[model samples]
Target: MPVITSRDHPLVKQLIKLEGSAQYRKKTGLTLLDGINLIQIYCSILGKPENLIVSESYYEDADNKHFIDIIFGHKPPKITIISNSLFRAISPVKTPIGILALISIPALKEQAYSRKVVFSVLLEAIQDPGNLGSILRSAAAAGVNNIYLSKHCTDAWSPKTLRAGMGAHFFLHIHENSDLKHIAQQFKGTVIATSIQASKNLFEISLVGPTAFIFGNEGAGLSKEMIQAADENIVIPMPGKTESLNAAAAAAICFFEKVRQERDSILSSNIGTK
Candidate 1:
């Protein structure tokens, strides 16, 4: 095929349009995975890209060539090698990786919705994409099995959020605009909602069974409806006078505490068995 030399090329414009809108990606059923690392993650999760765009100069390099060959080893997609300047035009990052892929977004399978999900992150009208992305990265680290985002939450598929999340998006089961109360009802375990003013301390609370954490937006915090919907309200004890911790920071603390407790429990059991 011919090289796409112009920034206004139809495919380039289409990919750029997906930069801001999740709706466009949903409608088109195509999501842009920027940079080599993210594209590699995409390949690992979603299979070979339907199409690959690369900078011509980088494509000629032996190292990049080998990496591209590895990625395309299974069944190579149509590759569009363009000039450096043109690649920069399409890239969203400051230091463009000069590589990107447009891949099909996998449909959420029936198995993804489970009544026995151990841990999940709940986003209530979180507007900032960075915070949402950071929370996702933290959640993935802390072993969260799913993420439930309210209708008003930031677009998880947007470019900025995707970049911040790195490759966390692939591993997460994200359900958008889901009913918080109904989902919580399905989960028999504890429902913990975090806030600054809550009477109970986070560490003191038992993270025993399946648990869901509700973290609200930075400015508004958890809404009354979300708080009421939760089974228990808890707070991360702060000895200092800091009014509130960042939403993402607070989430990391809660999630890791659960992980630590579970890990210690397993170790204690093994020691007793011995």
Candidate 2:
């Protein structure tokens, strides 16, 4: 394994830039997976990476040696070794993971406008990376196959967002820079948005068919245009006197309510057949 001791090494400089700049990442079509779990997910899903980077401070390095020697050494792969200090500089987190992988970002196909029974979520101007990530994870778990992020939302592919998503990004068809109203206009099924002024309750609506849930910014909630775009304006019933829910939490509740409704519908249909 070749060791990179100098800060001037081309790979080090490139990685430092990648960690710091989203524009650079987009330009290069590259992103770094910071920890072992993420690296493992990428490898398991997409086969071997082009390169692996390890820190000198990594304890029990023989495991990596095994991986490199067997799985990664097909073509004299560059599993570059570097000092701990250098790794810390390139890492985004406060505590650096011992190893990382340099790989091309996975390019998933965009979800086309279709009349099919698809479950979707449209996010507008969600600024928090952690919140965005949590929403992605919940969306995947709740069977929302399509996600549309407006142009004003934070970068979905950033390392922080990626970490927050865990491996959920692989499962979702994420569409960015979307037009929410246009999507609502073209949608075949119900378009639902939450509001404080809504007369209807969220639980009363049937999400059995194709449904699109639109959630807005944390502080601003839904804009007037987005609210007008929704086919139904409903409120999540809160008896506890809370003003509102966190965007991510509200999204999860909305998703799982759909899930619960669908499950009950399935049971009802089964029973009716009997």
Candidate 3:
């Protein structure tokens, strides 16, 4: 592994730009994946990273040597060992993980919708990176087929969002910079919009078939255009005095309900066949 002690190294300068500026990330089509788990997941799903960076201390440690060897068991890519200070400078978190990878952003096709996408979540104007990541995680866990983010939503590849996603990015099909109104119009199945004032309860609706769930900003909720474009407007029944749920929490509830309903349907079909 090559050693990099200077913060002014060309690679270090490039990483700093990618970490600090979303525009730079888009321009270069690259992003950073910090932490060992995230890197491992990326390698497993997408293949080798363009560059693997490790702090000097981490590289020298005998305890971590075996783990590193296992990570590179297949064809390894370029590896660099940098000084701790330089690693900290490039790290986004307060406490550096001592390892990270510079990787190309996965390119997704610009299709209206795929036939395999029976269930999806559309986010509109969700400004919080953490919330967006959590929503993505929930969507992936609930077996969602696709995720659509409005142009105003937070960047999906941002470091904070990637950290919060906990590797869900590798498992799901995500489309960012999308126009929710146009997608809603083009959708062939039910488009369900969540609202605080909607009369119908979420459980009362059928989520067993093709459906898209639209969630909006934390404070403002779904926009008028989004709500108006939906085939059905429903609200999660909250008996508690609390007025609402956070966007992520509400999305989790809606997604899992769909999962539960689908699972029950499958079981009922098997029983009928028997």
Candidate 4:
């Protein structure tokens, strides 16, 4: 294991660049996975990370030796041990977990909506990394395989988003920098968007078929073009005094409602077949 002492080391500088700049991440096709959980997830879903950076403390700590052994088992990648301070310098979180993995972003193909989907999500201009991550997590939990994002959305692979997403990035096929209007108009299935004034109720509708849900920016909400392009503008009714829902909360509710509807549909189909 190589020990990187200086913050100015080429590898250290590269990790900083990858964390600090989305453009750099895009240019290099590289991103940092913070913590052991993310690194383990990347290893399981994709493969072993290209490089693993460990804090010197972890290297010296007798108790954690087995953890490191688990990481490098058999086919280990390049390993570098740095001082706790130097490790923290490259860490995205304030409380450093003493480990990181450098890996190429999985190349998820961005293609047009050719066939109808059982479930898909289109996100428009979501700027908050946390919100975007939560939405992605929810989408994955709901069994959504495909997601499209507008150009203005936050970088999905950023450490904050990745942490917030909590490994959803590995499961999801994310298409970034998409044309929202074009996708909304071109989508073959039921394109649904939440609107306060809409007469349609979200639970009343059928989400069993090819359905795509559109969620908009946190503050500005959906663009007029996207809403206009959608096949249906439905609203999640809140009889309570809460005037509005947080973007992440709303997304989760919308996603799981589809899950519920689909479950019911499957049961009904099974009964009919019997």
Candidate 3, 1-274: lDDT as tens digits: 6789997899999988988888899899999888888888888899889998889998898866677779878567787899998889888777887888899998875556554438888999899989998999998888887899999898899877887888889878898889999989998789999998899989998888889999999998999999999999999998998877888999999999998988888899999999
Model 1 lDDT at residue 174: 86
Per-residue CA lDDT of candidate 2, range 7-105, in tens? 999999988887778789889988877777777676767776677788986734777667556544556345688988888888887788778778888
Which regions of candidate 2 are displaced past 4 Å? 63-77, 110-117
lDDT-based ranking? 3, 4, 2, 1
lDDT of 3: 0.88
**lDDT-superior candidate, 2 or 4:** 4
lDDT score of residue 254 within candidate 4:
91
User: TM-scores for all candidates?
Assistant: 0.90, 0.89, 0.93, 0.93
- For lDDT, candidate 1 versus 3, the one ahead is 3
Give candidate 3's error at residue 252 in angstroms: 1.1
Worst 10-residue lDDT window for candidate 4 reads 109-118
| Model 4 lDDT tens row, 1-274 | 5678897899999999988999999999999888888787788889888888889987787766677578668767888899888888788677798878899999986656553446889999999999999999999888887899999999998888998898999888899999888887888789999867688988888887788999988888888888888889988989999869999999999999988987888899999999
Candidate lDDT values, in order: 0.81, 0.84, 0.88, 0.86
TM-score of 3: 0.93
lDDT of 2 at 238: 91
TM-score of 1: 0.90
